[model samples]
Target: MQFLDTINFSVPLLANATETVDSSMVIKSVLLSLVVIYFVSKLGGELSNKVGLPPVLGELLGGVVIGISILHLLVFPEGSTDSSSSLIMNFLQTTAGLTPEATPQVFAAQSEVISVLAELGVIILLFEIGLESNLKELMAVGIQASVVAVVGVVVPFGAGTIGLMTLFGISAVPAIFAGAALTATSIGITSKVLSEIGKLNSKEGQIILGAAVIDDILGIIVLAVVASLAKDGEVDINKVIYLIVSATGFLLGAIVLGNIFNQTFVAIADKLKTRGGLVIPAFIFAFIMAYLAAVIQLEAILGAFAAGLVLEETDKRKELQRQVIPIADMLVPIFFVTVGAKTDLGVLNPTIPSNREGLIMATFLIAVAIIGKVVTGLTVFGQPGINRLAIGIGMIPRGEVGLVFAGVGAASGALSKPLGAAIVMMVILTTFLAPPLLRFVFPDETTTATLEAASGTSLVIESDVITLTDSQENELKS
Candidate 1:
């Protein structure tokens, strides 16, 4: 109240007292929400690290605590359609540029702004992922990665769809959505784990990373088809075909043209002596590609990924990576936290009669999700000496993509509350499961730092060097 008074008295406003109060209240609400999110996210991340869990998991748990489903600390109402809640709901709806007629639709719009910001966060995150990827490395592992990715998609989709229909007696349409949820591998989670273990350059790690990128593209295509089926009674084969062709063409074309653009950009920046030259242009290209991907009925992250690949081939790759990381760090948590916030645990409780069926279905999906990916380990038989189990385990987490599929299904009415909750649980569990398994199977390689004091030699810790030949090991022992 004191703060409100100071603001009102200080700013010479033309508006009435009530208008000022309302506006101030709205500002306070938004500021308070952001404060809670940042503080809780950091706390969650720190606690998660202490327990040997990924910070991402902690950040997500933090969101769940402060979100509507748990503490009810967030002011965004879901289903209350009466009195003060209704008034606040109406105000939110009006702010969203709606008629404010007060309906169930108004309830969903309450979090619209937050949802948009969360989406932006994910877009930026993907851009950073793309920037880190090397096109040459991706191509080198293309054949093996493509095979792994294709099989990964087929197995999980089949498992989820077939398992749901058989065990839970779910109908066809909803089963498809459940299957879609299991398809995409979260590159962010996989990459973080590999980097932590210092195996990112390992052959197994390379294949996993390459395969994950491929899976993302494939997953988006699957999402498009399922979404199309939901909207239309029959499948539009032409649209599906177009998505594949267009996405392929866009990425390829971007890479080829982006190389030329990169050279020209560097040349121009050198000649003109311009301030903040290439950075702005590079960002513009990423955002434009992101926008174009959305325009063409694919996920924006795809375009962002392509943008990163384009930039990866440029001379400014290192500088671009440096510039993008800070932005990604700031925004990525918003995406993860919002995803966590959206998850409703109540609907997945087995004790609830209404939720029992969903719980059973969720259990089935989780089993399929695990087994399907685990079996993918054997698919890398062509490459001997590589730990196939590590690759498979790395591919398990669904992360942002699964949440996206579940959200789409729920919004489209193809999935009920219980079923959506089930998918969320499956995603969370898979994310939680993969890291420890990877660590156990492919333990961190001994870094040069570990050998420094004893050897006193500046030997680089290459993956190949870590695995010494028999003679080398014998000599070391001697």
Candidate 2:
């Protein structure tokens, strides 16, 4: 009995020992990775600005430079990575005296922590975008935006799916999965670029923003249908209908209820007496809203966005916007940089025989990706002189949303290696190229200038230009 008791005690001791190492290594590794993220993001952003490109593009390239395709400094454990492929892992082994036996555990923990931070970064980004967006303008373009979103989804999905089946002799299931991938518009990336170029509130910008939001709803529905088919060989009509109803109700209900919430939100903020009087309550609301959305099977960012739209109606909106900017500046780059890092550009290499076919397939997908989205701009019947071309180009980038489709499809074993690679290639090209093209097509205006331009038709230019009113003149003389 005494010997048996000793054996149990030893096992607990060993387990505790292992846990301690894991906790220590995870902290060390995440800190180092954040240092790399901050340095590269700022450097890349400055250089990008110097060359007149969108800073987001530069931050993305900076991520690629440090990721698996190049320095391997910021590698993740997913895909085909080994201990040897990760610089941080090797550095720990060398300097921190990390035992080879403990490397895998430490590496996984480190990657998981960093990934969570990156996700939080994006959530904050969407929340900030929601604050900046004009809810009234977004609703005014509702019909046109819905039309553009449907066309954006239908055109690419139909073309890509059909083209793969007929041109490449691919099966219907895999083709459908790829088609689903094409349906997503990375609203995060699109909105970021629009904000960068002072186009976020223009008629075209609001339309694109509204359309992108709708596109996300459609993409989620399409994903559920295809994923079901991939598993069980048929669609789930009930589940599909549930998603459609839930999503529509969520949006409409939230906007309608926003008026009531806006007052309560202001009241709560006014009562708070401490340092974070405003921002703290604001974040709590955003995070809770994000959690609620995730609970209802919608994207958490959508919830965060809804939270912003609600809060924007409050009188404190301008002050809240000013407060949110620094927080955004701090966290948002991690999202973009991590997106760039996760992308493996090696699949595009032509010398490898396996990649040769993928490259060819990628070329076809890329053309379809561009043409399919570009045509959505022309679908607007009522909005004349709305910069149809800019709206189309704005919808071009697949960004991280496409990656989710690729990841899910690959995990379901429905995507062949070449087809997966081809999908990834199309996503990479579209994500990188869209920002500059959008900036080129939209006129450069200050935020004030853009607002003025947007309202130019409505402005009444009276003949009393540069003339003071009688009340103003009397006040000035006194």
Candidate 3:
């Protein structure tokens, strides 16, 4: 009598091994993701519209609700794996035979896929954002914005570091990591809120947007420094400086190279028998730039962002944005959902209050997070009728930027598990909290219009005006 090895021949294996087999586990993951995405996105949009908040805020809240630690407990009894789990192994195990020990390998494979998808999502997002952004407008306000951004980043970072060191009794590295976490301005949330409130083109909005961009650059530098300090006991001040300097240099070089290449590429595309071939080259250029940025220890999204900025000046800019949007729309939501899925609300459970230092730490970090950005509002000089408070609040949400920092910190071992957990909680809270607060504080078009009128700044409108055809205007209004 021959007996099959049940462990080696599970349902999951066959499902993963053949796409035609229709593995239940893969189907489960996909269906669950779709259901989660549809309901969460719909609920988020509906709630935000009802509350006069940005739909992104709703989506984020949806993410929080659908997260494994929250709604997933009732929906999926088996906990969701990290973004890095292996579907093949999962399938093999279900279809063929696999032991619990083999599951980790599956997880490792899945993580790679998640990372790639997340990366592509972010790149597309940044590119689209850049396409919509007015560089000239950003440049005109850059100096004042830079001042506000620098002060905002510095004060909170200092205060948080001090609090962590003195009040929390944490060591230098952990404190620094905490401070680093406090540095990012969640641009996505801020932009969405500003757009929803019709303040996106106001002087205050311009300053906030420019400042947020500067904040991102500064935050990445701080992250590099903190990561270094976490690795070695002492901070490598020189290395940190070098990274910043190098990143700036790279930015300049890329801008120049991109401009030259874009002109040449456009000329070639104009002559091409099939204009569609231009997209292939454009994507290739984007990938190369992204790769180069990664090689220099900078985030690839920055490169993608730069590429988009450069491409915007060319005739094909609209085409590129149009082409990328569909792909971006589909994949970007996955990134957001994955981010929300990572929330382990179990960490916040107070059942064992004595063992909840991480939650306490997270609360403290949230306080620091709020205080730090609020202070930036005070730093806006010479702009009368500017709600510095509003601007600061606008900068408060951590969103994707915070995630990037948390991801780097966790991967580098600079963040202890407790600290990392705390940071993530702080991120989720700030992301969820900022939109509602902004809506309450800066409510209505009248307030934004009043502020814009008082500032005598037409800079905002002139800057954000994307060329609109009659058809496009009709579409937008609809």
Candidate 4:
């Protein structure tokens, strides 16, 4: 199979010698960028792991070190389209006027292509997240999880909106986008920590995981609404309602219809003896959903998420997930590194009074983010046997999803560069801090079963529902 096709040059060249030469240069530039980005990103991930931080933090930092914001080493045609430097830039000028106003540049045409691939990386990343989610398991977690998810979304969003407006005097639309950026919880980091501590199957852990899934769904809807509002340049109540309704309906319709389609496609693919017969169709389903999502003015990741959720119910799920990972591993880092690269660190220089405002904003957002998730943990009060603080800590890390929100907002021009940088700063701080806090909250549970056994008592929340308790009511108050 031809893999890494986004960066790989496999298209047949024209018979004309000049055309072939031009294509070769383009291929070389792309290959060079990939080599540099991959190696640096890997190094960053390795370093982050060494420090007990998520590798995503390291990848993001690596991008900053090598990107235009720092070393000024990586250069892409941001607004320039010089034919001599970039064939793609030249092509864009002729076809789409991609070069803003008037500008010309060269060589980094491949960088533009890499940016597109980076976008695809995040979409695939979201799809993988969806694949990992079990709809039944999420639903079964019940009201406690729902409350946690809702509080997690609302608190940070509100904090971000009010903080940005008050601190930076930003308008409502941009402030809301900033708030949306803070609403996501990084499931990957939280799940890994839970697994390492042997708490992944615990009641609290289950609630955390379920809540994070719900958070992603809610965050995406917020992103859609905020992005639409920013694009339209006016705050129309009717438009907002339409966007909310459309996003909700699309998600429901896609899941229902996609499930039926998955069953039929799987049945047909099962009859085929060809290799990759199953995996290929599954990938196609994700791709088609992502395309359709863009058509409806929703983010492509939403479509990807739906595809993953639908296919996750099929018999081929394990194999499909296994196959999707390698692709995700290759592309996902590009997204993180690009996000890091795009971040302007100058706004974070606290020594300068002006730059200090950005730092203050970041600090405030981080507090909001951390407190928001901590509040989520407290909301699990109805669930006995679960550590409320632990659940909240688990939901604290915004990680990749936060970056996705900030990146999308920045790309859409809904967030200015400094605000975007500040958001990234908040993501970095939260991702770094959550693990140690989670460890502190849940000290020595050897196994989830052991924890469940210890929680032999129950607490009633709603009429018939029961939760296990490890602490007395007064102890919880303290």
Best by TM-score: 2
Candidate 1 local Cα displacement, residue 325, angstroms: 2.2
lDDT of 4 at 224: 62
Candidate 2 lDDT, 1-478, residue by residue in tens? 0001111122122245465446677678778889999999999998998988889999999999999888998887666787678898889889988788877767766776667677788788888888888888889999989999999999999999999999999999999999988888898899998888777878999999999989998998998999899989999999999989989988997799787899898899999999989998999999998888777788888988888888878877777887899998988898888889988999989998999888988999999899988999999878767899998988899998898888888889999999999999999999999989997897564322111333355433333123334454455466
- What is the TM-score of candidate 3? 0.76
Worst-scoring 10-residue span by lDDT in model 4: 1-10
Best by lDDT: 2
Residues 1-478 of candidate 3: C-alpha lDDT, one tens digit per residue: 0001001222243335343233343344454455556677677778878866767677766766766656541122123454224333444466656445544433333333443455576666666666556556656777778888998798878988898889878888778887888898866557656765666656777788878867877887887678777777667888778778878887788668766877887887677777566676677777787777777767676677667667766767777767777876676665555556555566666676643787888888899899888888887777788888888888898876786677677767777777777887788888878888887777563221112333465423333235555465455466
Taking the tens digit of each residue's C-alpha lDDT, what string does model 1 give over 1-478? 0001111133212245253324443343444556667787789888987876667777778887876567654434333323234344444455544343433333333344455556677777767766666777767877888888998999999988987888778889998989988997887677766755666667887788878877887887898789888878677899789979987887778768766776776676466556556566777888899889878766676677778777777666766667777777777777667656655666656788977766777788888888888777788856778798888898998876777787678768998776887898888778768767777887545455334335586655645235444455556677
Sliding window of 10 residues with minimal summed lDDT for model 1: 1-10
Q: Which window of 10 residues has the lowest lDDT sum in candidate 2?
A: 1-10
Residue 67, candidate 2: Cα error in Å is: 0.7
Q: How accurate is candidate 1 locally (lDDT)?
A: 0.70
* After superposition, candidate 4 runs with Cα above 4 Å error: 1-22, 75-108, 142-145, 163-181, 184-217, 220-234, 397-424, 431-478
**Residues 33-142, model 4: lDDT tens digits:** 67768988999988976876557667778887766567644445442323344333444446644443322212434555667777788778767766666756655675
**Residue 376, candidate 3: C-alpha displacement in angstroms:** 1.3
In Å, residue 131's CA in model 3 sits off its true spot by: 0.7
Candidate 2 stretches with Cα past 4 Å from truth are 1-21, 446-478
Task: RMSD for all candidates, in order, please.
Answer: 8.8, 8.1, 8.5, 10.3
Ranking by TM-score: 2, 1, 3, 4
